[model samples]
Target: MTGFDSHLFEGRTVVVTGAGRGIGAAVAAAFLHCGASVIAHAGRDLSHAEGDLLSRVPSAARSRLVLLTEDLAAPDGGAQLADQVLARTGVIDVLVNNAGTMGGRIRAGEETAETYDHVLDLNIRSVVALTGCLLPALRASEQASIVNTVSISARAGGSAGSALYAGTKAFVSGWTKTLAKELAPDGIRVNAVSPGTIMTDFHRRYSTPEKLEATAAAIPLKRLGMADDCAPAYVFLAAGSLSGYVTGQVLEVNGGQLMP
Candidate 1:
């Protein structure tokens, strides 16, 4: 059904972090297409243009697409971003903590303290801080939802990237459940999307197609996930009727690779 007819998120405002590309970008586009005003965010590189993200959002939704840039790992970065979003949108109904970075090019002990700190800061701390920073705005809404991006590596311990990377995402999965309960009384819902072997830029730079395909074949679905394929789950989580009763949960979008 058209978003207007469904009223899934007719007048809602959503902020999607790391929205310049990949799954983040796709999720933002899906929300905008479905009638939610969206804030497209990015960190450092490509934060300004958000080329691919801008291209995907239909012109009709452009007015609702606000591009933002911030370093979420920094102490006040999350609060700063929230202020900017609030200044423009007035109220935030949904938050998708999709910003993250991998511990690229590392070996055991070769991973420096700086790199380890960076990974944890960007992947874990930011997710928590951003959510917390935006909580006040979210509380004002009648229906509020927060979706955090997780990974199979977080569950399996490690597949690609450094061990620290996996650990950070695992934290998100764990926090989502507890946070859901903590915020339930406040009328807010928290959930996560743990993606497995998706075809993203990072996956390509680290794991080759052959390796990814092999991994996908192992799954019952027999294919790695695409960014577009993962978008709907974000929509579902934000759609109160679709996920109103759902909170403190992790929806694994993996192709049955790590069935739990």
Candidate 2:
């Protein structure tokens, strides 16, 4: 079977959370294209994710892609997903923790405890729990990679109403570095990708047309990014053949929006 890079990860297995939409979908497709057996974990509902995925891939690669439906927001969801994966396959070579929500731009003064709890549990807690549950599976692989999807908001502190979302991403960035150190000895590299103003539903819900123009003007690239632009960063980090020496770092995919 031929993959994008001609079987770059012919025998690898990857789990991509939030694979039903946007960046997550793109990343999962990229892995499948490159010959990785992918467990595409879609949250809450499957919707048409499986059909959407098949539309973007070749028939040969279709068998390698497994659609896993689960609610990662549930308390036991992460463990359940991990168990399901291990039951199907003995090893997981890459873990892409990409499921997240912008939480719809509530002002700091207007944010409720309920809102805060939901954001933390889905964005932070679920990521940690899932990784913990899958450590053994990852350890079994010869090359293990964890790619956490951070955001340009993490470094820039977000726009007016997204402080909480930005804060959670900052925690992700810090945790990436620390976790990298802890896993380095195990040969399990941890890294993050910080995407800038990608034109996804994230901005469709929170950003106005005027706001988008201002953001585009501020960037040296003079335009907003597509979901595809950010997908390669995840693939790069996951392919140890490409980034084996790289770890504990954040790769910014912001089109020069923020130099850091």
Candidate 3:
């Protein structure tokens, strides 16, 4: 449904985590629209997909979408998802490590070991595990691209109670750069998409209406972002023809909220 070429990703295979709803679903749908066979990890359940993700794809493209449900926070969760992917295909043209969460806003002093582990496990550990497991498949492709989901909070030190989540994102940002350099030898490029305050369910749960309004006012664009606004960045980064020379970069889709 985007303005991108329908055949942009023809004959390619893409894997997207957290695709049941919000930004992840939008990203998955975008790739499908562009003609890629998509393996979408729909979080821990398919309930969200029935309404959110499934509604986005037309009936014609439904055949190209494969939905899987997994709890990426569980033990060896990433590897388990990778197993499902490998069973389906040996070559992955694009890997979008977009499954992550804030886990909720735990105040600095109020945090516990359990909370720390939960956030780290979901945001950092799972991504590393998934990407590691998929390396062989990625290397099989003539050109492979890895796109990670980072956040404005990574650099801006997000609002109070989000320190742990922000730290995890920052870690991924650094990892994305490191992997880009390390994987370049194999013709695989690694990059990340840092989204601004998008008006998705993520904000609905963590950000109050008043806070969202204030934040929107502060942005130069005078509004918050959307899942669709962030989807194009993933498509652009995944399409080698579009960003063949780009790597180790964090493309910001924050609507001028952070100029840097």
Top of the candidates by TM-score: 3
TM-score winner between 1 and 3, please give it.
3
Ordered by TM-score, highest first, the candidates read 3, 2, 1
TM-score of 3: 0.99
Ranking by lDDT: 3, 2, 1
Select the stronger candidate by lDDT from 2 and 3. 3
Name the weakest run of 10 consecutive residues (lDDT summed) in model 2. Answer: 1-10
- By summed lDDT, the worst window of 10 consecutive residues in model 1 runs over 1-10
TM-score of each: 0.92, 0.95, 0.99
lDDT of 2 by residue, 82-107 (tens): 88787888899999999888777878
Backbone N/Cα/C clashes per model: 0, 1, 0
Better of 1 and 2 by TM-score: 2
Model 3 regions lying over 4 Å from their true place: none
Distance (Å) between predicted and true CA of 2, model 1?
9.3
